[model samples]
Target chain A: MTSPPAVRLTALTRRFGEVEAVRGLDLTVDRGEIVAFLGPNGAGKTTTLDCVLGLSQPTSGAVEVLGLPPREAVARGLVAAVMQTGGLLKDLTVGETVRYVGSLFGHADRSSAVLEEAGIADLAGRRVGLCSGGEQQRLRFAIALLSDPALLLLDEPTTGMDVEGRRAFWAAIRRDAARGRTILFATHYLEEADQHADRIVLISHGRVVADGTGAEVRALAGGRSVRATVPGLDETLLGRLRALPTVDRVEARGEQVHVHAGDSDLVARHLLTATDAHDVEITSRNLEDAFLSLTQEAR
Target chain B: MSTPTHPADAYDPAGRTPPRWGGFNRTLLGLELRRMLRNRRTIVFTILLPAGLFLSFGSTGQASDRVGSGNVAAYIMVSMGLYGAALTAAASGAMVAMERSLGWSRQLRLTPLHPAAYVVTKTLVALAIGAIAIVAVNVTGLLQGRPDMPAGTWVACAAVTLVSTLTFAALGVFAGYLVPGENVMQILGPGLALLSFLGGVFIPLDVGSTIWHIAVLTPMYGVAEVARAPLTHELPWYAVVNAVGWLLAFVAGAAWQMSRDTARV
Candidate 1:
């Protein structure tokens, strides 16, 4: 028999008293896929990741990792996680911390290799308290690599990193993923999800709003935004633009007007010829637009 | 669906070999011991307090009065040793509070290390700390030459005192899971002092008195009595019951709290 997917959640729900943190969430991640759980704050990204790590049980439903229960999978060294914060002891040096975690797996010698891969080998002697947030995140990354797990779960792993640090981190992660490791990370940054993930699963308020390739999810919004600079803008002109066929929404800011529509050509012609509008530009929707429209629609 | 009642029922569709309980980790124990040693306040409270108290009080009254096989000074020495061991063990066990606050416990839950293994490691650390405290207080008594006891009795008292501190270690673990990190020591410090009084470790109580009846019921009462048995030649059956009974209670409470601790809010 073949192995199951890397992770599977069926109708997973977690409630904290009156608040439902995760509600009826269902997702499946296959082997070697770099999947991103993209959502805004309080969208239940961390809650879902916690369930996958076996740190919390779902109030209802089931979770499976590597064709086994989450805890069982973790106990077999098949799954590891890099939490968002506070896993490092401030007093221990980076080297000691990595060595300690490695010893848990009986692989203390792998500490140096993982430290080198995480790009924190030179900071080995520095106390974790002294390390910068980005450096600490790298240290956490090093510890997560100690087990050489088949699946890696990262929850907002780059929240405190600079642009350069994020780039280096992703580069290292990409290299690791190339070795056939499955990675599922949760983050709110749309660009990070679009640029790195093979598949993006957009979640809002504990439910998935969209799930597909970056381009396909963008296409789900299915419209172009026509932007132009128009002088003497008034309510009548705004009304006319909103009344255009196939137009979804119209917005006016100073001398600029934005009209979202399925028919960009008609909106563009109406703006340039009918009104005194210049510098007209029409472009397909980006991931952020799709995220906003899709999440809003879910609401 | 109900939770799995047996380990065999855990999901294993791919038929991967199940991971066994790999005994306690030594590397973690070594690092934890090192961290405990580095904490100056723990050393001061666990070692110096009991040793200092013994030096001042053990020589105060009836210098040559003998009870059983030792003098009054020997009696006070045994009491002080038990006090220090209990304090040290409890403090060492309570280190879990800091580990929890740092999210280190949650981090460990993701690994192959078993939760029972972690608890055992912490208990071992407590025992180590307890041993240190017992040795420090006994050594101070030896160097002072104020306490008189046979070599065999001295070793026996120290061993019993060190071993009995396990009860307090479990107590510390229970309290660690019950309270926040910063508040653990603050609460347990005074709480232990009151227990010491009730146990008759600080002030001797008249036998068959009203307070004696109540003191025997406190958790530390059995520990104090059992540690001083070699000197007092007293090994009452109820003291053993009290010690073993409280140990089981605290262990159960700690296990319950720890299982809840992992259920993240």
Candidate 2:
């Protein structure tokens, strides 16, 4: 039989006391596929990643990484991760951190190469505490590369990075993917998912809301939101907007009203002519709009 | 991005051998030892404090009074040595609290490192620190040359002191998992000092006295009695029971807390 998918989660559910953080989520990612896990805050992305890393156990359901249990795969050095924050010791220099983790894998000599790949070769002598947030993130990335894992998991790996740093980081990741490494990353930046990921798995409230290519996800969301400053938006106007046959969601924020509908031109015309709306704008949907609409629908 | 030049065969997981010892390599242990030794607090609490206490209090004992195989000064020296080793081991073990707070333990879990291996490594590191404290006190005793003990007795006292201090190392790990990172040593430091006083490590208590009966039950009492056995030539069954019982209890406690720690979100 051919090797199993890089990662597979079947009906994964995790609970924290009374709070059900992850509820019956399912997903599968093939080898060498760059899958982006997209979700809003508190959408169980980190929780799911933790389970895949075996840092936390699933209350129910099965998680497989590299055709084996998560912990087993990890222990075999087939899986590695770059977690979000606070893993580095403040006292050790960057080189020492990389070397120390490398030693755990019996590959201390590879530290310099990984550091160079992570664009932190010059930072070897800098103490982790003294490094900037972006620098620290790069250091974490370097440490993850020490084992040359087959499947890599990154949880918000570039959160604190600068624009240039983010660019360089993705370059390194792309190079790894080209080497047949399966990469799964959880990120808040929709643009990163759109630009880099071959597939996007969007989760909301511990469930997969959408899973496809970026364009496919956007097409699946399939609507534009007409946003305008409405001075007198009341329940009557909201009700009227909700009554529209084409509209999917009607939301109000401060003096602005957002009406999501398939026909944005018709919606914009209705707002400009039929109601007292200013700054009437009709815009095409982007990944952000798609992310918001999909997650909103899940809720 | 540069394309990977190597063929996909290089990515095969089957080609690699799994790490031995559950990722408990000597390199990690070496790094841990260096970090602990570099900590100024470790030096002050483990080495200087014990030696300083021995100098200050041990000097007051009359050199003429003989207790068992050595003079009163030597008995006090052994007691101080045991006290230092226990404190050092416990403090070293509790360093896990800091590692946990830093999320380092979580990171290690993501690696191939087993929880048992982590504990074993930490315990071994603690034992190493305990050895240093014993050596510091014994060397201080040797320089003074007033303890009046045979070379064999000194060797025996140091060895027993180092080995029995493993109880405190286990206790430290248990407390490390029990309390928050910043407060672990704060609570354990005073707690150990109190145990020392109760165990009669710092003072002589009459046999069968009310305090002596309570002392025999304290964790440190047995360790103190056992370490000083070479110098004092007295061995009680109850002291051995106390030492062994606490060791098992602390190890179990540490294991339970470690399981819970790994299961946490």
Best by DockQ: 2
**TM-scores for all candidates?**
0.87, 0.88
lDDT of 1 by residue, A201-224 (tens): 999999998999999888777678
How do the residues B110-188 of candidate 2 rate in per-residue lDDT, one tens digit apiece?
A: 7777777887888788889888888898888888877888889989988999899989988988898778676788888
lDDT of all predictions: 0.85, 0.86
Residues B1-265, model 1: lDDT tens digits:
2233422123233433334455356778898888788888789877899999888878776856997899889988999988888887888778786688788887777777877778778878888888888889888988998889899999999998988998888888889877867579888888998999998898787889999999888998998889999999987898889888998998798778776776653
**What value does DockQ give for candidate 1?**
0.32
Candidate 1 Cα errors over 4 Å, as ranges = A1-3, A227-259, A263-280, B1-23
User: Which sections of candidate 2 miss by over 4 Å?
Assistant: A223-283, B1-8
Going through the candidates in order, what is chain B's TM-score? 0.88, 0.93
For model 1 the local lDDT of residue A167 reads 92
What is the interface RMSD, in angstroms, for predicted model 2?
A: 4.4
In candidate 2, the residue pairs with backbone N, CA or C atoms under 3 Å apart (3 or more residues apart, or in different chains) clash, namely: none
Pairs of colliding residues, candidate 1: none
